[model samples]
Target: MTSKDPASPGHRPGADHSKHNHAGHDHSRGDHAGHNHGPSGEKHGPGDGHDHSHANFLGPNTEMIFALASGAALIIGVLIDNFVGAAPGWLPTALFLLAYFFGGFFTLREAIDNLRQKKFEIDTLMLVAAAGAAALGAFAEGALLLFLFSLGHALEHYAMGRAKKAIEALAELAPPTARVRRDGVTSEIPVEELEIGDTVIVRPNERLSADGFVILGNSAINQAPVTGESIPVDKAPVADPALARARPNSVLAESRVFAGTINGSGAIEIEVTRRSTESALAKVVKMVSEAETQKSPTQRFTEKFERIFVPAVLILAFVLLFAFVVIDEPFRDSFYRSMAVLVAASPCALAIATPSAVLSGVARAARGGVLVKGGAPLENLGSLTAIAFDKTGTLTEGKPRITDVVTASGVSEDELLRVTVAVEALSDHPLAQAIVTDGTARLNGAGIPAAGDLKSLTGRGVYATIGGETVWIGKAEMFGTDGIPALGQEMTTAVAQLREAGRTTMVVRQGGRDMGVIGLMDTPREAAKQALLKLKDIGITRMIMISGDNQKVADAIAKDVGLTEAWGDLMPEDKVEAIKKLRANEKVAMVGDGVNDAPAMASATVGIAMGAAGSDVALETADVALMADNLAHLPFAVDLSRKTRSIILQNTILSLGIVAVLVPATIMGMSIGAAVAVHEGSTLIVVFNALRLLALRNRYAESPVAAQA
Candidate 1:
């Protein structure tokens, strides 16, 4: 048997395809000659001659090269001193000088710059230690100190580069050129040159070059790179009123595709909705860059400690040299001990401890399609005790579906459904779509009567004229309230029963009579229950569901997802108030996916946006953005943050503990060479420890609760 194509309309048994003509599109005939397309269908070849040259002449590899050269020179100098004592002293001196200049030149320059700025950095301490070592006639030890210190710098630079490259890789995902169709003719053009509303054609297995909605064709899109979703999502034109209304650029919500996502083996045409620079991928790149610049709590503390510690070390070195001279100790020996003190007390390891871990954590999160705005949010995630979630899109799928239908005694189900569909077709609300979808499916190829004079009743529902009859489809109160047709006891009881079952119920009226009551529910997301359990396992004490949805629906979803509490029928301001109340007790994080939740999210200690891959509002407002719509990555983020925090603490203590042990050893006549080894060794250890966070992964996979549910 041939493998079934899930993207095809007929893949599901009993799916209605009469309205969609899938046979006419030829996916295999869209290949254009002389155009190189990547696996994701993004057109290859440089377009617009965009220059990517950077001004830093040293490049990312310069430090490593200098470090290797200095190390080799230091080794050669030591060999000469040990085995060729008869050789001229100048020979060993020249080699040592070469090593010092090559390895210590940058460090000295940075120290001088810091001095000019009235800042005492770890570089300053290293320079002072090396200078004193040289002055004390300990050229070999001084050269060794510079070489080891430079090697540490090189390794730190390399570690930071790896993290930076992870974010930079996003820029390479979008192709430079795109194939645009204008006036029915397709031609290759620079992606930057494509304007809004321009139609772009993407062939099979190509990456989308721009964010847009598909006006035609059907396909499956692999959005793993942008959203961290493992499963490929099916793409087709679907009438979603909420998406259309919220994102005006997206004409058919289901047909929307983002730049950098790989298209399946089906050709589709998309109308460009956003410019190349404004694409979701570009926003991610920008956000990641910004996040790297924001300092974490630990980083700030380290900086503050360095500001005081560096100066204190300098004063202590000076005092030691003065006291030794006053006691009639040899000036050279006194200087030697003072230099050792500088090396032992330098805060290089302490300074790097926090930033390295924070950067690694941020990079690791980015690779998994989660963006932590900066070190602050990354650090904050570890401290969050309670998390508030918006129900519609955070805990639930946000897509309403008709689940139950109750018709009046004389009215047939088909007649009730037909009248409902005809009126709901005029509405753009999520519930309206559910009614129309179920109604149309049950119609079985039967044509829906035209709806006329459609009027929306704000939040209540819709009013329309269908086949010359005044039909109303909305909340039960809309029909029974003052000056409107009152619903009978039978229909009211039916609506009440549906509501008690946690379904959003609406009454259908035709010609001023109650025809039926329809029940619609936005089901909980597949991963919601498992994600909640995982959050609890990760030490999240309080989980609350906050939503504008009715109380029963909110409570039902809260129970389904294992939340500790549920707050319902809240306005945007009410959500903010609820967050304030939660924050009064403990650190609270708010997770949501809409503009309405922005205030509440901002009010919480940390704001997390779900399904951020497509929404600019989520990208801009939330502190942390879970690129995908599901909560699979939420637990991972929390675990990673806690790990990062723990690692920073470990590094800080180890670094300080080394200085505490080594400084006293230096004063007690320990060799400067050993002091240098201990000091530089601690720096390396801290860096390598921080690097461990880069490899951290979720220890537990998402539970199978979602599948069971």
Candidate 2:
């Protein structure tokens, strides 16, 4: 059972995953570096100077600054005409030109590209109308409108692009080179060169360079990058049966391995089992790419609408032109007015409203270590009704450890521990590691011999000779109930409690006598509860946990995590059934960390997979993959989406609402320039509001009031 501790503090600053400590050995000067020519590509430069390649026209606030400058110039020009006498045409012309080229050049280029593609893009229309207005001597109006709109577009693009880069860059955690072992020799080679069945030695604390299986040694591995779980997994040799029985994708508990995960403490030698591109990181990239293909009803409708929107705008423009001509307005004035109407109705702001918001949201999510694969899943996340999680590896640590031990009359605690740890030392089970670790510490320090004979009994126990006495370490049931009283009620009650707490309790019997009971549980993360409370307070309801463990174990964890429902002993199909049941009425999100969770993840309204701990199948099936293993990320994602949706609505309403009030007034000739100015300025305001999601919150501080809404 995973026990969560919500109050844990942040990690050590500057503690990147790339930094590895090799247990008093500096592999940096080892033979591997001499063979690789790794430094051949290096070109050291002064760190003080800027890297020109990283710099582009895309400067922060450039768009907003251009918009403000152009808008102010237009308002100044109009004010000169309205209040002071008319300024010289050259003066206004010069100001307008400054704004036009600075603001319009980039936009015009994009507009031209769209036109070349035979697309009646809003940018093209806006450019044409703004230029036409300047030609008609409404220089100030044209320049201001052009600048503000262009700024919004640029800012939106930058924010969205940043998010895409973050997702694509996540796989960089895996080192490019791996140490391959062949014929008892070690050589460093690019990770991509690795193939199945090759033996690779991953030294202590180094990230696994590729996916493989443990061939020798043992260690604790922290796989938070793929599974998004922060806990480290203890690994042993494949000889341990309990670990052997673990699901194949669970990194083989002892033998199997993954790419891009770090060795927490010890070391392991693994045989390559998967190709580089088939690794967990690659699968997440593939899944995120595929999620873009899934569309929401709103998205589909909008795309279809955009297809016809341009032609419809043309018809409206023509109608306006004819009406003005029939009303006997001056030909030039009527023509420019008609163009303005088309520009105003081009849906430029509306076109950007949803995607810009979604993109910003996705990018913001990435900054906070959440990956929202597409607009559809992002939209679903905003309204999630129920979230179901697999108990092990999803809600809990998945690495079960020995928390308690009890012994019978003749066996002292130390003797029992020593015998148990000795037999377990011969195996690779997580429980075995716990016993071996705890027992080794006590034995070596106190000079007790680690046991031997160490023959494991299939599905039962280990047979070994300890201190000249034949010992059998396993369950009471492993030895048939001859005449011994069934475990006492208290023992049974204790076992029940352990199971309820999501523990896998194992009984250790030595030579037909009950030696002791060892309880193994996967404790929950420290941040789970606080994050859950934050989520609930923010409007989430009906949390659930689904697991392959027994009902007693599942129930215990559910109670602790504050889940509203718990289902245990579920197969993949069982999980899907649970999702189906939940989805019968409301949106459901399934969070999981194994291959078994794949189908159910796909079936849910929104599927979240732990990037650090999950297998390729599970990652591929999920709509959103959390780069960090903290479940708190789910609620953080939800918070971001909801906030983004709110921003979109605000921008949509603000833009359309201003147009509703100003468009009619402009048509009525009541200071149309000022009305247009307000409309344009408001559009810029709303666009900036949407971009604010880029600032990710690092702490669970009381959210600001603006975010609360």
Candidate 3:
């Protein structure tokens, strides 16, 4: 089915009414200027940037020709040494040095780079080890070491490109233009030119050009491009009663369509709802990038370890060299043996273990439709003791819709519906939309009357004069203590029944008398029940629902989701307290999307926000943000974390395993120092194995095909 907009549709009523003025803009600077320029300054395709970087080469094709010739010479020299057994010393030496120089140049440069950064890198150790091997008359082994290390470096670069491909793919999904309606006529315009209330016509086989609602006509849409679900959704006029009960399908007239999803076969028109930068897809990209930037606790510890590790290795190498020479050993043997020790203990495997796994884990989460902010958050997910979810949007769909209308005090249903819709028409809240939409439909063919002097009481109710009659509509509590007197047992009992069904009950008053009550509910997501059950099976110890909604609504949802504890009617700060209490028992994870929830999000051991069009403040504060609000991915992220941690431990133990056996072998003199050289070199080999995670593909196999396509 079509994907819904990432933002909570009914949470803020007037949010969609804001002006969107990006029409007729020149985005040539952003889109066109990314192309590469050739030597003569002509714009070229992607691969043409190589011209500028290699311009100072000895000549065109010179480097390529030299490389091939040098490689051939080295191959021939090795053959002669293996077969003839008596090549001239200089020939073997020269050929070996040439191969080392060409293949090892980048490694040497990287060594220098690490030195400049005031850190010791594995490159420097490899270089030292290779030099020592050559001095020990092991020319072939030294050359092979350089070649293998270079090969590993190239492979790592390619792996990084693959890891980043998802983001690059997402950036390319949106098309640049849209069809906008102006002055009663449709015209082709850049998406930037879209303005609020401007009807945009989306044709067959095109992406929904902006986040907007249907204003006219009908259509079906393909939302799999963004939602990771492969279903086509049907849309029609809002007046279709049968369609209204069909769970919205995320496919209906005037329903929000995200940026990347495609419009289906039927043609329909939509009103521009939000600016391009504010679209769901845009916010997901932002959140993913931020997550990549924030370092995890493990990453920080890795950095600290590297700083001390390099100096310690240097000291050990010097001490070994001094002890051998003072014992009357030859200076050459002593120095060379010292270098081998330095190479063997460089800690390359340790340095790479954390960040590489973290990078892969984040990418995996994105594939599952979750956007974890950084390595730290992903690591924290596994240790969570409790999870606090915001009730309005997190536990429920967050969009309230009219469920039932009842009349009392002899008021007709038609009269009650008409008055409610008229007053709610002046409001922009989700509850207001639910009431207005349902009221209008029930009125059926009744013409709307002009509403007068409509005044809204923030967070409460509304007062308006419609058809020359003053109407008051809001919660029973809104009627002041002395005004409505205490509630009768019957009224309270009725309200309790409505609340038990997870509905927000608001009383309707007319001419200072109670007419009846209306109930609205933010329906639960279809997949939530199954997803939460899966979480429990996978060892999620506790789940709690938290919301700014009233207590009755929160408890009803908590029961449905199988959460024994629920907290409602909380301000942002109060939610933080609830999270703090959960944390006192064990690690707590707070998940929310409102700016009001930012403080609690930060206070929790891990904060997971809804990144798909969620607020900037919430995205920034949350340790993780779901790029799409697909709850199934939440469990998937947790699974990836456990796997990543296992891989890291394996790499650590393997590296240390080789060291433990080899180090003592050298001290006992059972073998020459050459044996230590072989063992030490194996560490580099083991490190390359751990880096395989960087090349992992389809870790989240069910990720949206469009993310790759």
Candidate 4:
């Protein structure tokens, strides 16, 4: 049997799963005719109760009602004891006991449950304190203590609900019903019923229902909630070589939209690529929920301390009572002092210090589009001394661009470019996209003859039949020095110059002769240099660049980005080895974006995935995921993690220091009312201190160095 007690750590008060319906019918090619089908074929309209604007949660109304009643009873008991001196003694006693029972009942129940489980928590400490006060004939004071304690617990419950509400609020961003078009007819249907390849029409100001690519029309999309990009990104139909090659049937090869992003002024139709449950928004919500369940290092330490502290305090209080009794002190004085000791030493503030800070830190990071998987990662990020980065997609833009095109003696630049474009257009390599893009611009819409019998030579290049001639494009070594005698000293000099400038040189050949050499470079991000400086400013001493590119290209990029070291021509396993070696000396963080980097990232002390908005693997595997492809977030994450760790330490010290000071005072005859006030005040102080983390802003936003031109 599961207990419904909210105070129990295992009890999740508002965790209701009945609202989301996972079993939904496929509406991809269904003929709707006139009716709209909601979940399970239920008829739905705009006015139907499918609105997700408000997410409901079972609030702390019950706890509030009991606290209010207890407060009223305590007031009346105090009034009767002071003002109505002639009143029956039993009247005040009954009123005080009523307040204590009403306010402390839930706490006592949780304490008993915890005791049965062989665990002790704040509830147990609170119960013992209240009981000891009542045993000392301080009924009004004891009742007051219970009322305040219950109020604090209820407020904390409400605060935590608000924190969780931030995640729940993401669900409301997606409408329950989506306007889906199938068989040339459009109808409203449950979002969960959406399937891949189904056309979804999003009107102006409407939230997207699934991850998809635009098939028709144009619009701006606000992705702040999903990617933390404050400005709306313009979307239009344009050719994307990668997507065009990978998804030939994709309606709009240009624009991509994610679920939960709001459509701007224009109405756009998107073909769904992911289901509701698989959307980026859903993953974020799921991750946040799971993150909250994991304990931080400080929280674990506090729990361990409590395990020893609670038992030791109880024994100490009993020892004090026995010692006083053996000294022939009056029973009243002995018991009163012992009760004071129990009230003072209770670790209420210490118990909540770490979790409160961790929750706020996680929520703050989420607002900035950084998803920290759990508290362990958050703590680990703070201590990272060296950071390893994947060059292509992490520091560079990941999109290669043509820098120089050199044609051999007889081959004209135009002829070589036209043949290269025709052949590379059929390929999906990053270099292929660069060639196609540059060639298309130079051709100016002039049609090039289609390449036939195209074949890709992995790691070398591509071959195709263009203009009834066999054409080849790839590495310089593929053509061979013996066969391409025309590619002499001039070609070698040009290739060396381009490679020295950090460009990837590709050799183009046709009919067993060198046609030309094209230079492609995945340039560093505009913000990369500044971001590296910021990382160094924050005490990240070692910055290393790792890449599968040639050593010369890697060294050039590393020099441009101010990195301390660069490792090139390394395979995936080699990258992992490098990360492990770095981890042997100090805490290391690996930043990467592709599948090849996943293993290395996993091996690092903290794995950070850049541009995780599109990759589900990055979202699931990395310890930290930066939604945007920008490197600027790295320093911000590091700074925030450090701040969180510092705050946790500060909170721990403040809580423990208060206990150390108050325990001695209580044993020396501190009043029960004074001990309760100070104890509850310390807990409140710790909570407020944790809340301060929520106000921490991006320190690099306007830094002088970050703003340098």
lDDT of each: 0.75, 0.61, 0.60, 0.73
Ten-residue region with minimum lDDT total, candidate 1: 30-39
Q: How close to the true structure is residue 165 of candidate 3, measured as C-alpha lDDT?
A: 47
Evaluation by lDDT, superior candidate among 1 and 3? 1
TM-score to true structure, per model: 0.84, 0.68, 0.72, 0.84
TM-score result, candidate 1? 0.84
Which pairs, if any, clash in model 1?
A: 40-206, 40-207, 41-206, 41-207, 42-207
Against the true structure, candidate 3 has what lDDT?
0.60
Candidate number that wins on lDDT, 1 or 4: 1
Task: Supply candidate 2's per-residue lDDT for 410.
Answer: 67
Worst 10 residues of 3 by lDDT: 29-38
Q: How accurate is candidate 1 locally (lDDT)?
A: 0.75
Candidate 4 per-residue lDDT, tens place, 1-709, comes to 0112222233221222233211121111111111111112211211122221121122325565666778899999999999999999899989999999878866676566456655555566667777877877788888988888777655555554454445455545666778999999999987767888788999999988888787688899877677766467788853553464367333341376788888999999887877777787777766765675566787777767876777788888888877664786887777777777877887777866776677677777776678888788998999999999999878888778887888888888888888889889899887898889988898788777799898876777678897777887877666563353345576778777877887788877777677788998787888789989999999999999988888888998899889999999998889999999999999999999846799999999999998777777789789999876678878888998999899889989998999998999988778766887788778777767777766677776433322210
Of the candidates shown, which would achieve the greatest lDDT relative to the real structure? 1
Q: Rank the candidates by lDDT, best first.
A: 1, 4, 2, 3
- Candidate 3 stretches with Cα past 4 Å from truth are 1-75, 85-89, 116-119, 135-137, 175-203, 207-263, 266-290, 323-329, 402-433, 439-493, 496-518, 656-709
Give the alpha carbon lDDT tens digit for every residue of 255-310 in model 1.
Answer: 77888888998899887878877788777766775675577887777666766666
The number of residue pairs in model 4 that clash at the backbone is: 0
Predicted candidate 3 versus true structure: per-residue lDDT over 74-93, tens digit per residue: 67668877776677757876
Error of 2 at 616 (Å): 4.7
